[model samples]
Structures are given as structure tokens and as C-alpha cells.
Target: MNFSIARRRMVERQVQGQGVKDPRVIEAMLQIPRHLFVEEAFQSQAYGDFSLPIGDRQTISQPSTVGVMTEALLLQGGERVLEIGTGSGYQAAILSRIAGKVYTLERIALLARRARRVIDSLGCVNVNIRVTDGTQGWDEEAPFDAIIVTAGAPSVPDQYRDQLAIGGRLVIPVGNRGDQVLMRITKVAEGQFTEERLIDCRFVPLIGRHGWQEGES
Candidate 1:
């Protein structure tokens, strides 16, 4: 199974085909061997256009969705990024390619450990993974140039908004339990942001403080 060919095709067909025009994003999607991020049994489907389960009931986001969400960040390189919900760490990997550094958070211990191993194996030294609640944001690393939230939340978390550097972008999925709209919020000034809704999508709930309760459906 030659993953490079599959990755190219996946980018041309599923990602680029969706009008994701960032060259950096396309290159990152091509460079990352997405198959390694999944279990060996599911590696063959890693480049597929649809999402796949990665364990602990979380799903590795589909290629197009990842592309879309990432492209929305408008990363210009050499920026510190905060990623909530690292999942398989695939998103963080992409972020690492386009940003100077990436800090990702995963609440589930098992997922966080597995993702760390995979990220380390890929030699993505720019990515830093932490096991903890995501909605709190990383205050010590306050004012990120960009933030990407992988989970769907009922509403945007206030902490996320507060942690953005001026003119930084926060890309997130917000709405209900089963559906969400991708939103790009740019912090133009202190306590001021402008939002643009991108597309309709679905993702697992963001479980943490300032987000959905752990047991909520």
C-alpha cells in the first residue's frame, strides 16, 4: 500500500476538489503519512474522504473537513497555535507544517498518549501535546496566533476568544450535538472579533469546562 499515491489522490480529489486553495495546506496534507495516524487495521482507509473511528469513540476528521478547517485559519507561518482536541494528532501535524509551533490538548488520557506516540514517531518536533481539558485554553501560553478546535461545541468558549492574539484566528465547529457550522473568528482588538461561518459539519461534542459537560449527550 503506497500511501503517498493515495494521499496525493485524496488531496486532489477530496481536499482540493472542495476549493481549499492554500498551497501550504495542500503540501502538508501531501507530506503527512496519514495512515500512520490510525491503527494498522484501518491504515488503508486513512486517505479516504470520510472520517474513521480512532478509538475512545472519537473520529479522525475526514480529509476535506480537515483541509477546510485548516485553510480557514489562514496561517502565514511562524505563528504559535493552540489546538483543542488533538484526537489522532493528525490535525496538529498539519498545523505544525504551516505554523512555527503547535500546542495541542487532549482530554482523554488514552487518546492523548497514543497521539503523542504517533506524533513523536513522525518526528514532528514542532507539536506539543498535553493531556487536560481544552476549553480552559492555555493561559500560560496566552495569546496564540491561531486556535483550532476539533470538537463541536454548543457555543464558542470564552476562554478561546480571550486567548487569541490580536488579529489571530480561531477556527471551530459550533452548534448542536449532531450538527455544527465551521466558524472563523479573527481577533481584531481586545474583546473584539469578527466571525465568518464557513460550512455545515458534524463532530463529537467538545467535553470540558466552558464547553459541554462530560456526561451531556
Candidate 2:
């Protein structure tokens, strides 16, 4: 099957049809080869609307979910983005296309290694992947322009809020492990934030200090 054509259809039918209006996000989704981020056994279904396993007990978020989460960031260009959960590096690849830089964190070493190989193979140099607890929120690179958490957290992490630059946005899914609500939070000013709920989503548990503990999933 022609993955490019399938990718286009995915954008039209699954992503855009679901109400993701940002042209940049749509174009990024169109350009990235998501199949390369998953196992070859599942590559044929990579362009489908649903999420697929990427090993290490993790999954790539559904295409529409990635679209909605990315659109919520409203990235114009040249912004530093922190992606909490680099499973498959698919979301990071998308971010790399739309942002100036991407710092992604994944706890599972195997997953991180696999994702790095795939990302490097695709020449996504803007994405920097690290193996660490994502709940800490990459304190060394704090005050980011945007932060996207690809896992479900029980609540918003205070560290994430403190790391956002004024006018920065953080898009995350918050709720139980099996269900979640996507939230977009903007740091308008010091100690002042505005939040908007986007859509319902489901993601693996964000296991770390500020999220679900390990083995909880």
C-alpha cells in the first residue's frame, strides 16, 4: 500500500474530520512517515485512525489524538517544545517539523533506544530524546515555549506549570489510566494561567513522581 496516500487520507478523514483545524499540524501529519515509527508488523496499519503498540508496553497515541493535542499547542514556528513520553517518537517527529526544537523524555530504555534509531533514521535532528522520568518535566530546559505530555496523568504536574514560559502552552491528558480529558493550559503571566479542555482521549499512564507510579499501569 502507498503510505503517503494513506497518510493524506488519514489527515482528511481521521485528523481534520475530527475538528483539528491547524494547517501546520495537518501538513506535519501528512509529511511524517508514522509507519517508520512502529514495528514493521504493524506498519501497514500505521495510517489507520487508531493507536498501535510500539513495544515496551506503550503505544503511539491515535492519529486524531496526536492531531488534537498538537493543534492545541498552536505552534506557529521556532518554539522550544518538551514532549513528555517519546513512545515511538512519532509525536516528537511531528513536533520536530512544527517547532524549532523538541526535547522528548521516555522512561523505558528499550523504547527510548528504539525511538531514537527510528528518529535518527528519518533525520529528525531537531528532536532530542532522553531516558528519564518525565514527571520531573526536564527542569534543565525549563521555561519552554510548549510542553506536550503523551501519557495520561492523574492531575497536572506543578513542575510542568512552573517550567512554562509566559504565554507558553502545555497540552496533556489528565484522568484515569483508561480514560482521560485533554487539557490545554497557557501560562498568561506569573501564577496566572488559562486552561481549556479540548477532547476526550486515552493514553498509557504517565508514570513518575508527579503522575501515576510505576507498576500502577
Candidate 3:
């Protein structure tokens, strides 16, 4: 019943306990009420160590996953970020606390609308949610300081790498539709990047050009 306390416990246990060392990531997990992002029926499980459905077959990534991905970005402060899957907009809400701005894209309009309402209600005005094919990467808003893809893709999308600013970090899951390896790619120079595998993960298929087609999933 006490959501605030539950949230802190989540950060201390599911997040920080998982070895996510970034203070900003931990603080964001502490500040945001995860319960608000899920449907009313599932609100009680918001702070649990698992993902919850947010409709449209999408999920709010588990707390530890969110922490790991966010920490991988290494956000110090005031950097522009692009989130490839808005889902419940919970990740965007978390990023809004540490990033200068968050541009999130969701392929499903209904999900986008729902995420927008929740994000707006939280007064996370720095998060911009748009309904679009995320695999394309927001070219008009190119050169993001950090890029995070919440879904699993068959391979790393070229558009994402092309749009990243030099020295920027991109955290994404790359593999089959049912399984993936979380990867961190840092753009060191034009057409040059270093990759690190963080963890094995499973996420919804990233459906779009340069990702998995609808039929493939």
C-alpha cells in the first residue's frame, strides 16, 4: 500500500542488488512510481522483480533490466537520449531524471497514447513519445548522446549506430526473437564502435525495418 517504500525496496533489491552501480539510475528507480506504469490490475506487482504487461503485448522491463540498461548508458547528466520502445514509458520516465531530453518511439499508437498519458501525469515533460517505427531510429533528431532499444532485434540496426553522437553509448538486445544478448555499443569515431555484452536477455521482438518484420515474429 505504501508505494514509496515499495519503490525504494525495489531499487535496493532488484536494481542495486543486481550490481547496477550508477547513482543516477538508482535515484531514478527510487523516485519514479513503477505502479503507475502498469494496468490497475497489475499495480500491486509493480515493484516486484519481474516485468509486467502494459498491453499491446509489450512489457515494462523488469526493474533490474531497466537499471542495467540505464547504467550502461553511463549518463552523467543533461545528455539527449533516444529510447526505441516507449512501452509504458517507464524507462523514458527514468531517463528523464538524468538526461536533458528523452525521445521515445513506439510502433503501436494505442500503447504510445497510453504511455504519453502516464508520462504527462508524472510531469516528465522532457520525455517526448512518438508513434513510429523504432528500427528506423529518429533521423531528424539524429546524433543522440545515448540510445536504448527496449525490444530484441535480429541484429544491431545501422540507423541506430548512424544516429549516435561520437562518444555516445547505445544499449540494445541483439539476437533471435525469443532470446538476446544485451549489448553496449559506444561510438568512438565515424563508423567505429566498441561492443560489450552485458547480459543475456529476452524481450519482445523489435518489429520494423532493420529489425524483425511482423511476419517473422
User: Model 2's lDDT to the true fold?
Assistant: 0.92
Pairs clashing in candidate 3? Answer: none
Off by over 4 Å in 2: none
- 10 residues in a row with least lDDT, candidate 3: 208-217
Deviation (Å) of 106 in candidate 3: 0.5
Q: Rank by TM-score, descending?
A: 3, 1, 2
- Estimate, for each residue in 130-180, the C-alpha lDDT of model 3 and write its tens digit: 898999999999899999999999999899999999999999999998899
- Cα lDDT of model 1 by residue, 51-86, tens digit: 999999999999999999999999988899999999
TM-score (C-alpha) between model 1 and the true structure: 0.98
Per-residue lDDT of 106-168 in model 2, one digit per residue for the tens?
A: 999999999889889888899988899999989988889999999999999999999999999
What is the clash count of model 3? 0
Candidates in order, TM-scores: namely: 0.98, 0.97, 0.98
For model 2 the local lDDT of residue 111 reads 93
Runs with alpha carbons beyond 4 Å of true place in candidate 3 = none
TM-score, cand. 2 vs. native: 0.97
